[model samples]
Target: MSNTAQELKAEILRLTRDYSALVHRANRAGTENSVPFEPGKTTVPYAGRVFDQDEVEAAVGATLDFWLTLGPEGEAFERELAGFLGVKHSLLVNSGSSANLIAIAALTTHKLPANRRVQPGDEVITVAAGFPTTVAPILQVGAVPVFIDNDPATGNARVEQLEAAFSPGKTKAVMMAHALGNPFDLSSVLEFCRRHDLWLIEDNCDALGCTYSMPIARANALGIIENSPGIPANGTHVTRYTGTWGDISTQSFYPPHHLTMGEGGAVNLVSRPPLKTYAASFRDWGRDCWCASGKDDTCGKRFNWKLGELPRGYDHKYIYSHLGYNLKPLDPQAAIGRQQLKKLPAFIEARKRNWEVLREGLAEFADKFDFTLPTHATGWTPEGFTWDATGCRTECSWFGFMLRVKPGAGFTHTDLARHLESKKIGNRMFFGGNLLRQPVFVQLRKDRPSSFRVLGAMPGADEIMERALFLGTYPGLTTTMLEYELQVIRDFVRQA
Candidate 1:
């Protein structure tokens, strides 16, 4: 490269840094007492991106490189993300929904033995109350989604129903989310998967930093027995991040998620290399090539061997592996992700702190509302305000503070939500509560009743739909915001 080119690149990066600092300053000034909490005036968002100059600079830097497609930055971000999750591999994709698509698609690959591969019509167990994309992938791949009821308090699948949802050979996988960052019953789910030899795909988009303790036997089997820093790992159990407990896990980096990269997501392969290759193939246009972007012949025999009926020495890069989509995110998005990842620890801590404040503030009104707490394994209890972990526990980086209006409460969920909105505090319903009740699913059931199956009447899912709502626990919420939110809720309940 010419010296002039080098100088130009340096100058562009310097300007990017300056612009980023300016943006940071403007952001701080704009937010400084710009909008004081006023009931019915200032809008309190349920969740949003919380970022700084570093993210902007990284994004701008990637832009300057003008390598818009998935490349070095994406590769670096994948490595960084995999390291954070303590997983074998991570594949960047356009959205969490796409991550879900590719994760399931990977399991359907011919590379996996026929006995283990998720064939069309195979049944995948999932919760009836979750983001639709968690179940959409199953249908998209022509697999049958077996819907199970949720535990209202935890917004998780009822583990007790797993067996009922299972079909001896038809049931191939259990794909579910750690709803709103409160992990489901990992112990029960893991044991059920083991006993039935079912694959587990954890939709971890909402529960990035949440940790779950598993019994030693199960933990070891999942290869999560390796000690995590600062977390004690002794006795009959071992703690692993929720994502690691599953065969495949996914993350979202959208503005409202735990971390933001403008718009991005990842497929984390936790089990083995074969799965990673299958997932990568799906993300990278279904190419048989294992080479990174802009590379060639990663396998020495790339052009030397034949695949299927293709002639020998045919460009391996052109070889089709699985029927896949081009779901990879741009390099700049991954660049921002690399920066956001640096702040994830602090972001997670802030979320936990905010949720705790809200929980403690609402404790007095426990009679008025049934507040959702993160679920843990057996033998867990609250000592004082904190849960005492007796056997296994879930340490949640809470995504939101969920509250369900009790049946006899004078106020209804809609009433409380409106009250909060009127007070300029934002709230959100649990995503697609009782999803079967949603119009899309209603139509699917009507059009083709055999498309999906339900285990039993989803009473808990119905309860969540009727009574549950959640407040923000994102890092963007300051103490003042949280306090004001608490006051609004208190005033509403007190008035009632």
Candidate 2:
């Protein structure tokens, strides 16, 4: 409560208001005529960064504070995010990829009861259409990843195929993304996890606002309607919202993701024990202290306890619990995140509206081109839409689209990609489509073939991914821009 500190806080608040007003004015002034489409020159991205003056100003103000490391903004952002997601805990990390890595890595801890530990060579079932980080954690930890072929229709894994990916002897965990902003069949997956005692990790990077419900709706989604001692299961899944399920769910704060903390991610856990919660302690230099970033000595005796039989009185600050990394993000990034979070409601609504616009524009082509519009599971609301290009005839949210070429479709993915590229529309494959096809996975898979398996051979994965591309649906896009992009798509299809 120093005078200087109070003054600084006041100044920061001033800047936040100033920046927000500027953004508001800019939005009002820049109407339809302000932005024009530049054919053959402008880049219509699959996804891109979207920020207003609020984000820019928050980041700039944090720079003035000069804390540089995790500080007020980081702590506030973590708490705000946890509150928003309705989770008990949220730990910010350097990247969504790192968030996934740390989340999956946390499961491998021997500290957890043995049944929960993901043993080496044990299978972690997932899809091939997701970003590499989703599966990289499995390989990084020496575990086997059993790839499940995605349903071309939903751009999600086939729930009926869950049993096929599991072998009683090897499978220990199930990790999968919600496939762009669309939800996976969470009810069945949760049941499958319960039956097999598998660790469920939902990579919510792409599906941040999604909510899910159980089919039976008799009790809690994971069964045992209430939380129990030793093993807790009091998680309520009574149709609240989307982007809220998982034994341990993760979120991304990268620029292209739902929210931006520049380059950051968070690990969230709900109603877990102090012991399980403390498991994440290792991530922040593995310290025993639970104090927020700058404060210290909340535990009265800072150097009175002896751990690991070291000394009569060892420093608590120096105590290390688990092998971990310095994955924490800087406060400025978190400051930006806090500000960005304020706009999430609007951002989500814009994405949904844009998705509808794209859906309407491409409705006529639905039969001629194979397009799979994602359908939300009961009781879930998604942030965006994901369509499959299996028939090479699809219309997804224009912020970005996914296309999977069908067998004997009379066109190669490259041809379709080039066709779009020539017309000034942007395109990209589903992240590491058939990740096992990548060179990095060759050695990992070769060394542990039996421990690993690919769902349905996923030959279509390559076709869908290679042909798949998306356009930007970020908040920055306007209706005029989206319509112009749609025209480009229509023109390309007609010529083909």
Candidate 3:
């Protein structure tokens, strides 16, 4: 590396920081920088990039290195993210959807035991609502998706239906998301999976910073031994981030997620060294070699592999192990992610606080709306949430503040969404609510009824589709912005 090149990179980064600081003040954490608030005039985004000069400088610096492909920066970010989540490994990908695709694909590999390997016609249980991609990959891999209902209150799978959704010999895995950053009924889910010897793929894209816990006895019974890093073990419970509990979990680093890498996601190998190889194979074009990008012969025997009728001593790099895709993100994006990871704890706290504020502010309208509750929450008081009898609990770094309009609230969710939009407040319905109702699924059902299975009437999912909407609880929301959102909702509810 020449001195001239080093100096040029430093100058570019310095100017990049200056440029970003000037233009991105409004995008900084709300506690750090104030964006002008004009009620009904300024747009209150549901979620957006919340970064300043640090992320910009990192991005610029990585770009200047000219290694556009996933490389040094990606490796650093993966290690940092895995460390943060207490996972064995994190494999970066282009999007959360791709991470999910790779996770599911990894399960299809022949490397696993025949009974455990997900094959065509094998069933993977998933919730009916929430993001479509979480379930899409099941069908993509030629496996059947057994759709269970979501609990509208928690916006997560109805764990009690796990047994009903399972098919004895055919059910191979469970793939579901922690909806809206709320951890699902992991205790029940884990128990069910263990009982059936099925794989668990947690789509943790929305719940990156969320924590779930069960009594130490219960956690031990389920074979979970360690709390995530930085979470104190209080002798009563085993607490871990949502992603770390499952066999393989995924994250999204898109702008709206817990952290942004422009466009990135990761597949987390939880407590397993082998899963890393399988998942990485799927993420890196199904290559048999374990070499990182731009490097070779990490395995030392790269030329000695013979599999799938390939010639003996064939270069392992060209040996295809599984049908896979190239889903890697750019190095610059990961560089930004590394910066975002540094601020993630604060971002998480902000999200939790923002959601709490919304919940408390709207408690008076509980009659008009059914607000989201943590998975084990029985009720919410001004002081705090009351727990269910399960002795299990969840702490959400909420993706959004979800609420469902009451049946007799004199207005529909659509009406309220419009009202909020008219006030320039951003909102979103639960993604692909009642996914079966979406055109893609409807056609899928019509074309091949055997392609997927639905457990029940999915009334809960239907209820969410018809009644629920969510407001942004992202870290970028300012006091003024939140106040305006609250005021608009209050006015609308009173008018109704």
Quick one: best TM-score, which candidate?
A: 3
Better of 1 and 2 by lDDT: 1
What is candidate 1's lDDT per residue for 66-123, written digit by digit as tens? 8999999999999988888888999999999999999999999988878789999999
* Full-model lDDT for every candidate: 0.85, 0.68, 0.93
Q: Residue-pair clashes per candidate, as listed?
A: 0, 20, 0
**Model 3, total clashes:** 0
Highest-scoring model, lDDT: 3
Alpha-carbon RMSD, candidate 1 = 2.6
- Model 2 per-residue lDDT tens digits across residues 1-496: 6999879887776877776665444332113533455666766555555666677678877887789898888878888887877767788888888878877777876667776777788789998766889888887777888887877666777777899889886788899887777667776787798888887888888766544433324334455242211222334324423334557777887766767777888887755645334546756776666666677777888778777876956877778766767888888898889988888766776666666666567666653445545544211123444323221111122224454454455566677778767866666666777677887777766876665578767854665565555545566666666777788767766666
- Over 4 Å off, model 2: 1-37, 214-237, 240-243, 275-279, 375-400, 405-410, 447-451
TM-score versus the correct structure, for each prediction = 0.94, 0.84, 0.99
lDDT computed for candidate 2: 0.68
Q: Model 2: C-alpha RMSD to truth? A: 5.9
Models ranked on lDDT = 3, 1, 2
Candidates' RMSD to native = 2.6, 5.9, 0.9
